[model samples]
Target: MPLLAGFATSLSLIIAIGAQNAFVLRQGLRREHVLPVVLTCAVSDAVLISGGIAGLGALLTSSPLALSIAKYGGAAFLFTYAVIAARRAVRPGAMSPADHAPAALRSVVLTCLGFTYLNPHVYLDTVVLLGALANQRGTDGRWIYGLGAVAASFAWFFALGFLARKLGPLFARPRAWQFLDAGIALVMTTLAAWMVLPAH
Candidate 1:
């Protein structure tokens, strides 16, 4: 019961539309650096979820400085990525999968790291929220619950990154790519704004 609950809860949190998902979809569609990106996301989630199970969530909440640093740093990175996506939208030339040059592995891995770590929400969702939720199962059930959550993470990332190739037909046109990049730019900018703005 705890395992199923954990899987459902973790899937609910992760499967939502977000910057990281958007990036993964884009890369998967392009068929570029998919393995590394998927692995990075899954591993990051595992580490974070483990930390949460270990009670890092409470520690994170009490550390205002750490949260602040993550907030500003993430916002800056998002804004930068937004600009790049916007530029791609304007060009709309390399949108064709056949003509596109694959990005370097090093750069791809770094960007994946940034998207996974720089976002404050990742910590909140994985460590604080999930940790607290898992602990609800008590000591015996907590680790099992956490294992379920970790399994969900692995399943979701791999499916998203690998299964995205099926979208090849839909994204074939340059216009489709333009629209996708435009959407990405919009999402990134909005997230960046949300990061800096005061809560209501």
Candidate 2:
């Protein structure tokens, strides 16, 4: 029951559309460094969830300064990515998934890391929320609960990254790629604004 609860909770949180998901989806569609990107996201989640279960979440929640730093840094990064996406949208010729030169593996990995680590919400969701929930099951059950969350992360990333190729046909058109990039730009910009703007 604890395991199921953990899985459900983690999935619910992760299923939300956000910067990380957008980046993963883009990489998956391009079929460029898909394995590395998926593994990076899944492995990062495992580490974050584990840390949360071990009480890092509590530590993070108590530190306003740390949260602020993440908030600003993440916003800046998201904004920069949004500009890049917007530029791509304007130049549809360069948007073809198959025609463009593949991005360097190092650049892709670094961007993946940025999306994973810079986002304050990632910490709040994985470390603080998941950790607190897991710990509620007590020592013996907490690790089991955490394992379930980890499993969900792996399953979701693999499915999202691998299954995304099925949409290759749809994105074959430059117009479709333009639309996708436009949407990505909107989502990234909105998220960045949300992060920096004062909460209601």
Candidate 3:
């Protein structure tokens, strides 16, 4: 029961639209660096969830300064990415699955890391919220709950990254890519603005 609860809770949290999911979906559609991107996200989630289960969430609670730094830094990175996406939308190009020139492996990996690490919400959800919930499960069940959460992370990322290829036909057109990038830019810009705005 605890395991299932953990799975459901984690899935509910992660399935929400966010920068990480958007990036993964785009890579999956492009058939570019899907494995690395999926693995990076999954593994990063696993680590964060584990840290939460291990009581690192308390540390985060006690350290507002750390979160503040992440907040500003993440917002800046998101804004930069949003601009790049907007530029792509403006100068639209053919991005067929077969025609894309593969981005360098290093560049892809670094971008994946940025998407994973720079998001303050990732820390808040996986570390503070999930950790608090896991601890509520009591000592014996907490680890089980965490395992379920970890499993959910792996399942979500792999399914999103791999299954996204099925949409290849829809995104084959350059105009489709332009529209998609514009949507991505909009999402990223909104998120960045939200991050920097004063908390009430």
Using lDDT, rank the candidates from best to worst: 2, 1, 3
TM-score to native of every candidate shown: 0.98, 0.98, 0.97
State the lDDT of candidate 2 residue by residue for 1-200, as single tens digits.
Answer: 88998899999999899999999999999999999999999999999999999889878988999999999999999999999999999999989977788999999999999999999999999999999999999999999999999999988899899999999999999999999999999999999999999989
> By descending TM-score, how would the candidates be arranged?
2, 1, 3
Off by over 4 Å in 1: none
Clash pairs, model 3 backbone: none
Better of 2 and 3 by TM-score: 2
Each candidate's clash count = 0, 0, 0
lDDT of 2 at 24: 92
For residues 84-184, write the lDDT of model 1, one tens digit per residue: 99999998786787886789999998999999999999999999999999999999999999999999999999999999999899998998999999999
Model 1, TM vs. native? 0.98
Off by over 4 Å in 2: none
